[model samples]
Target: MPSHRPRRLVAALVACSAALLLAACAPTVALNPAADANDPRCADVIVHLPDTVADKTKRETNAQATGAWGDPAVVLLRCGVAPIGPTAKPCITVNGIDWVLENDPASPSLRYITFGRIPATEVVIAHGKNGVTDAAVLPALADAIGAIPQQKQQKCLDTSDVTSPTGTPTAAPPATSTPTPTPTPTN
Candidate 1:
């Protein structure tokens, strides 16, 4: 009985060791600190994070400033970035927050950095063979990022109607349409 007990204990120890090793191998994300790392707003955003994004589950991140989704990390998010100013780049408002997307096709995957948030966010989508696009993931994070109160002057460009010399709102001329001519008499 004593000999059998030692064998059982040894087996249990080996099993525990294997489990720990596997746990250690689980995915971990490496993230760079953003310019707004110490901003109070970041804390509010981090706690509201959903368990998943873009249908991919959120994985453990190495730092408070980073978030990662998917096994190979198809979608990565980092909050509290330096605010971006107006540029020639295209800007689109998503879920009420304006976003400036910068695409670098030269890289293996497309990386989209958020434009207008005071504490901007960075979303990286791996252009793997799977062909995953940022559109698949960006929406999931929009509202959460929008919750961080934007400093309009610093974080966003006013997208209001362009002013005219008289300071009146620019209105397009009424659209006109010509009635189609009747061909029934010819037929």
Candidate 2:
């Protein structure tokens, strides 16, 4: 009986050591929940999240309305964030959606926010091997972001789009091309 007890004790210690080692090997991602995390639009986006981002595998995170990617979590996205108002950030339209790039020199990663989107979304990525991570991520995330209804203030006007200040779309001007007449040869 004494010999059996010692054997059990030794086995238990070995199991505990192995468990601790495995836990340490796992990746960690720490992020905070957005204030508007409970928005239904955010829930829809979360459910539709991609399995990966920028070639890095998506990993589970503790933050609400958030998604993570990479073992060390190179990319992090948070939905339902407060709308950005009149920032000097450079904005660009992608896949019919406008995005604002907030380039902070003090930060190691770049930040991107969907322009004119309600319950706005923000993505931060550690600069990847290729210089452009936003180009890879924004396209994949466009539809999900577009699902959220846009506020009137959030609408972007493309120069190609013909619309009045009253918000009604107007017909675009006809293309102007001069008709070239061929001269008849005299016999």
For candidate 1, write residues 60-174 as lDDT tens digits: 8877667888887788778887766767565666666667767755666665666656677777777667546666676777767776776655444444643547676889997
Q: Pick by TM-score: which candidate is best?
A: 1
TM-score of structure candidate 2: 0.65
Please give the CA lDDT of all the candidate structures: 0.72, 0.79
Clashing pairs counted in every model: 1, 1
Tens digits of lDDT, candidate 2, 23-68: 7767657789899988889988888888877777778788888998
Q: Measured by C-alpha RMSD in angstroms, how accurate is candidate 2?
A: 13.6
- Per lDDT, the best of the predicted structures is 2
TM-score of each candidate? 0.67, 0.65
User: For model 1, which pairs clash?
Assistant: 100-115
